[model samples]
Target: MGAAVSDTSTRTTPEHEASRTPSPPGGRSRLAALGRAVARRRLLVLLLTLVVVAIAAALGGDVAQRLSSGGFTDPKSESSKAERFLADRFKSGVPNLVLVARAPGSVDAPSASAAGRELTERVAKAPGVLSAGSYWTMPGAAPLRSRDGRSALVLVRLGGSEDDFRATAKRLVPKVGGRQGVLDVSVTGSAQVSVEIEKRSEEDLAKAEAITAPATLLILLVVFGSAVAAALPLAVGLLSVLGTFLVLRLLSAVTSVSVFSTNITTALGLGLAIDYSLFVVTRYREELASGRDVTEAIAQTVRTAGRTVLFSSVTVALSLAGLLVFPLYFLRSFAYAGMAVVALAAVGAVVVLPALLALLGRRIDAWNINRALRRLVPHRRERGPATEESGFWHWLATAVMRRPVLFALAVVAVLVTLGLPFIRASFGITDDRELPASAPAHVAAQALRDDFDSGESSALSVVLPETDADAGRVGSFAARMSALPGVFRVDAATGSYVNGRQVAQPGPAAVRFRAPGATWMSVVPSVEPYSDAGTRLVQRLRGAPGAPGTVLVGGQAALLVDTRDALAAGLPWTGLIIAGTTLVLLFLFTGSLLIPLKAVVFNLLSLSATFGAMVYVFQDGHLQWLVGDFTVTGLLDISMPVLMFCVAFGLSMDYEVFLLSRIREVYMETGDNTRAVALGLERTGRLVSAAALLFATVMAAFATSGLTLLKLLGVGLALAVIMDATVVRGLLVPAVMRLAGRANWWAPKPLRRLHERLGLKEA
Candidate 1:
């Protein structure tokens, strides 16, 4: 609620055909039977999918309409209490729109003054306007004019939810935001910023879709070696996405889902659909190539890859579900949307894709889009530890295993160094500054910061919920607040007091400072907001000695203080839930306490790296030149890093699922840890990297976004994804496992039995 405006922004593979360990007997037969059933009833599966698609489309089209723009602040905070109380009682307790006007020369110019006055008048008359005041109209309001005399602000009060405000802003923007002769007009405020952010998010989502969709298709085609095969993953992705929209729509009835969650849902849904479908189709092809009949191949594919796909989804969905631990709907929305997409992706790939594969048979590769490209790209089978394609992964594993300490230390050093920036991360609230410089809202916000001084209007308010204080009592409290270190003035029902002295007599405007059930006062800080002096002053007021009733602090400052505390408070629990789930899932998969601990450590380390990168790149303004435009806020929003951690950890674990399943399968068969590590790398390295690349592509597409927040999410997640899939999962995992030796798969008898009974398995 900083500035009282808030905005926030899998895989499987199976293989058969290699004569290595021979497929396990017990579960394979059952999986084969299930696959045969699905294959034989392919028509029914298709029919069911059609029904789902239609239903989701019908209900989910309005999902975007249902989404909320801002809910990042904690409701438990004192600031939230004040905001809600004020909104309910005062009708327009907060200023939601600011019409900023600037003359090329100075506000002293007659023409400029006229234009500024005209702009404010037009804005005041605009639909939904509650009250508007400016230096032009409010004769003595010095804070509304720039000290330099070139600019001024028209503050507006429009009462509504963020959605309602957006509707108002949409109609009012064109009327006020356009250039007016020599005076430039721009709109920016709590509500305008939210509207701008929503608009930018929409543009960025469309752009990302336009960019990622084709790139994903091309990559899938190359990976699957045929158009038909590639299309299946795309189809699963579409189904997951549309279905997630429907899920979000269903969720809307219960709670607010931030609009920013949509980008993540679509990107993740597509990436995971592709990831899961890739595993399923590849295994199906392998089964077919192994000379199995269609029905048998489908069964074998389901037995191994299908099972692996389900496991991957669980890990990913659980990783996201961990986000539910945080109270903020912004984070929870992602968890809900991600869970739906992942569950649906798993179903599509495991249950639906198998039927399609069964029907396609050998024709799954019929289109052969990679025929010409095959000469350029060596096949996965041909590439080993010696060749270039997937061989580097093999070589890296072998190299790391040969010198575990050296590789492990080296990789750890690199990852830790990448994470170093986060140690210095100064988390702050997101403001209009997160918008690109080209945006009018951003420009207007900058103008406000540059022009306006700390004053009564710009200051924070404290509300007394059940105060029955007489005018004299209110005057005494005002005097005490005025004496605070940085408080220049205080406005209450009795009068306007400055420097602990009464300045002006109570006027009609004084009614704002009083109410029958409650009384409120504004505290004007002597120092500029967000500065050390100003922040310290705010702290003093919050702790100030005397007040009549239940006082709740509400303003940009309180929002920051409360939000920071909330994130801190919720983090340990969020971490527990996330780490706990990861531990349980990995333990079930690997049957080893050490591996799950190892996975949790590695994931946190990688998340630190991502957070550090966010701080360095976006917060520090390191890539301003390359990333288009945004002023460095010098701090990342609390929500960005927290949400990123949940999503990225899940993504990192996505690759972990693919790689570990292979490692576990091989380990169970050979009992040779080193061989299992190498073979797992050999089996999955190419696919994992490809999947990471494609996922990265989807993420990176949003890197082109004009919105700084979306850019941060995209770039930060891309960094985590690529590094986790390649460096962490590929090299470090092998090195660590190699160093651990037998301990990598070690578990006590009791836990091992639990795993045997409860663990999910693939062929």
Candidate 2:
């Protein structure tokens, strides 16, 4: 049962009217007024909150079904255009459905050949199949037959929308896969890969939630020292996650939203809810302990901690908003989910939470677990400081300040050393290897890598939009392409060429390369499709002459190049948005240019260290023992670093705001910088560390995901949070403040006037 609010001083009409008539030298505080409003109508607020949450839960029940499993390519890129060109003009693009067929003996046996041809023809007649070819059907296609002579590939191109392709694959695989006469078959390709990833992601999310929910509740119970207090944050987190799912579901109807965003929604929802709740509830308990009654304690908590929550949420949301600058919806989807969850979490903490606190009052301190712990141990000290100057954090801060230069140098050196490995970091696109080894798609891909002679399924498509079916001109261009380094063969209207020689005359396959004014050829490569050599080959092909008309190259390699260029072009703007907004917001909060600068610098350092650690473990494959096993592709996914930076930087700034707000409060009360730093650390030290530990626990649960990218995100963010809280906030902050001294709070005269007029500080 919840406690009833007995304080009637602010509930009376006369008192409320007097409170509204504000005249205190400084302007009226909106946050404090909001607190009073929630207090005055606590029952209505709770009822409305529950109604909204129930609506969200209902609307978002089928959100996972609505989400897309892929958005990694820029739809406007040239590679995407070329792909569309092939499917539109020639009714064919790259093979998106592959059947790897094996025989009891050689695939060339009569029974195996008959089964393979039947399989190919069956797939060609399927609803969404554009065209299908195989080792048995296409003459001079030696690469499709594995070197061991037992396995062969049946490549089928499916033409439709992405959703249509997924539907077709789901239908066709079950009907035509498994066994065909004397041949045994396994299915793979982009369609199958997408289906597998979607399934794995859903499984990972369910498992992560199962792990984090009870673990986080137990951690919160320990951190708050009471069951009633701990339950509030979990309630807020549930509301935030469910609310974000509704937002994402609505967004998916209008635009593409990635299924991967669901993982981020759950992780950040719980993490931030716990963070803001810790700040608010802890501050409320402190006010109550300092002798404020239910009403005033709620009001003060809202005025101070609620404002900090507001400012911190803005910083985090802005950082995530930077992802919108990227062309790929994969990254943009995260921006959508992250900003939505942050807004909902802040609202839940600042509004609904205070209302609940008003209803509960001193009952929040009921079911005290720490009291039982104290009784059991009898000698262990209680959590918070007995005095401002006597706590462990206070002692640590003072000790660091005493040797500022040494502490700063030592901390910087450690961070820089951790960041060294990132200098050699390489980037590539994710493939089937992102799935667990046991996944069917991954198993099929491994068979291709080991058995196949060349990467035929991942060939480059060079389209000449205005070219006709002229034998001389087409054959010349095909010869030049086949001569290029890493190219295995080129299939054109004229013929199939290898090493600058026409090895076979035009056949049935060559007929597919021409339609009206448009013609296309596929340049198959011998190198790994997503490797460094493949990239180099794409660059060379783009520059190679001998085109009858305009040449547009498209494939996995071209897509990689275009995506990389797009990211490079958009990165400056993303950085500008994040950095510019962060500077302006921090200045408004602290009324100090130097403090904001220091915060940004420290955040960059912390994030660089996180990136370096990721490169070391995920990129170079050093710690598979600790983070679990994964295929070491020798290059990290190109989108992952950018995604991680935005998420981790925003979270690191969350801790910065928490520490700086408390320090500014102390400094405003006492003019001594050293004492403010020490006292602030003493007050919030346990709280920040506890918040980071709990958030890290949530991220760590997701780190156990079978998807390597998800694992990288979890491990990287967990490291960033812990390092920021302990090393950067706890150690470097005090040392830097000691060295900066009085200048840390200084600004120009005009800026100071502006700050005094419109700054976001509490009175």
Task: Score each candidate by Cα lDDT.
Answer: 0.77, 0.87
Residues 660-705 of candidate 1 have per-residue lDDT tens digits of 8888777666565677778788778888888889988999888889
* Superposition error at 404 for model 1 (Å): 0.6
- The C-alpha TM-scores of every prediction are 0.90, 0.95
Best by lDDT: 2
Estimate, for each residue in 1-763, the C-alpha lDDT of model 2 and write its tens digit: 0001111122223212221222343433677778888988999999999998999999997798889888888889988999899998899988888889999999999999999999999999999999999999987754699999999999988887677788889889988778789988988898888888888999998998898878888899999989999999988898899999999999998999999999999999999999999999999998899999888888889988998998999999999999999999999999999999999999999999999999999999889998888778859656875666667998888888878899999999999999999999988876788999998888988899888988887889998888887746888988998999999999988888999999988887778888998888889998977788988998888888877888888998888989898899889999999999999999888778898899889988998899999999998999799888888888898998899889988998888889888887766655556777887888888889999999899898877799998899899999999999999988999999989876777777788767766777754
**Candidate that scores best on TM-score:** 2
Q: At residue 326, give the lDDT of candidate 1.
A: 69
List clash counts for every candidate, in order: 1, 0
Clashes of 2: 0
